[model samples]
Target: MSNDTKARMIDAAIDALQRRGVAGMSFTEILDASGAARGAIYHHFPGGKGELVAEAATRNGQDVRAHMAALPGTTPAAIVDNFLAAVRPVVAASAGGGGCAVAAITVEPDGDALRTIADTAFTSWTTALAERLGATGVEPAEAADLATALIGLLEGAHILCRAAGTLEPFERTARAATELIRSRYPHQKQSR
Candidate 1:
């Protein structure tokens, strides 16, 4: 009911969602993970896992948007490079071993809530990237397409990296992304 409690629930849900695919997850698991009682989960998410997941998905989406908004650039390629750099520590810390929550949930069967969240997050991320791209002279729709490609590459790379337990997949993907970005905006300078 309280803002803090709601935030805690979302945090716990995010952790659980990341670790377990949506449908396979349970209310008991979330309660145990967050150390909250059934009443808390009910009070915050009466519809149970689906509601929590939807909220979690929105939270995650907002996080990505925040990162994009916080960027100091007016260029699409620069924003993406910064985003990738920001993600590097997370990937390296896990030894490149974890698929993205959005990507994972998108694949699981009957995880409509999870899938919706994933789709929304990815869409928001691409939208943010598209804004940056437009600032750098890319047409709005073209920027959106570019943003989608970048996200797809990043998400797919994360999955591969996790499966291989190696950073090579990520590095390779980053290299290709950099190249694609450069080819698309040859005159644009890369952010340090």
Candidate 2:
């Protein structure tokens, strides 16, 4: 298959994983969504759905990490706000149709390879957040802990917002997370 076809398949798989979870995704669905030829699936992903899904999940995680790393701010509050801003559109676009790909995959019993991808993605996010927090003077250990909490807050809030069919949960969690991060750096101006 051509590289375009392969990339489209990956993109389609990511969307399917985010929207429907692992059990819901199928070769037929991917083919329909991507508009790739049936032969492309085997050509691109000889290992079948598992390989394709794992690659898609890994790419999603990397995209998230890159987004976090590129957040344009020097302060924890600014960083947090930027992070929320970056995520808001995605959640809004999904409109309760789906949620974070890593979160969705983590909860499903999709075997060790997929689980490891989810774990790595979560770790990448947490590590990026922690590094940003540490740059703002939070101790390394405390920043790590807080970063993990922030990830949990955001992921849980995403699920809650999806379930409730409203953005209120995510909004509330974003505010609380900003406050928590700001609290750690009390000297910074509070303008979030």
Candidate 3:
């Protein structure tokens, strides 16, 4: 099997995890979503669905980490603003939340290893976010806590928006996250 097939399978697995959670995500759905040869599943992921799910969840977390690293701005407030600017349009254009893959696995990890993977995914996000905030004048310890709060706000916003089928929750979350940064570090004004 080609690497392309493996990547597609992983991507499909991520989608399944987000939409269906671990208990509901199925190999059949992964294969159908990916358009990968059924036989390729075993060839690509010998450890089976659990292994595939773990990899997908990790990838989802890393994808967001990469996005945060690339967000524009050299200050906390600006970072928050730029990040919101990038995601707001996508959130508005979508039918609703994209659903968080890591959270899906987190809520229903099938095994101890899967649980660890979920924790790693969450920690990866906080660590990446903390690094960004810390670089921009926020104290390291405060940045870490702030990062966790911001991520918590984001996840809560996603759930609320998905349930309500509206962007108002996200708008509130964006404002809240921005206000939070402002309150915590009133010294770091928006760079843009």
Give RMSD to native, each candidate. 2.4, 1.8, 2.2
lDDT values for all models: 0.73, 0.82, 0.79
**Candidate 2 positional error at 100, Å:** 1.3
Residue 20 CA displacement from its true place in model 3, Å: 1.6
Q: What are the runs in model 1 whose C-alpha is more than 4 Å off?
A: 93-97
- lDDT of model 2 at position 57: 91
Runs off by more than 4 Å, candidate 2: 190-192
Per-residue alpha-carbon lDDT of candidate 3 for residues 1-192, written as tens digits (9 for 90 to 100): 499999999999887776677888889998899999889989988998878988898888889888867777889888778878876754553325467788777676347777787788778878888888888888999889977887786677667777888889889888878887778668766695
The TM-score of predicted model 1 comes to 0.84
Q: What's the TM-score of every candidate structure?
A: 0.84, 0.92, 0.89
Highest lDDT: which candidate?
2
Candidate 2 pairs with clashing backbones: none
Error of 2 at 178 (Å): 2.2
Q: Candidate 2's C-alpha lDDT? A: 0.82
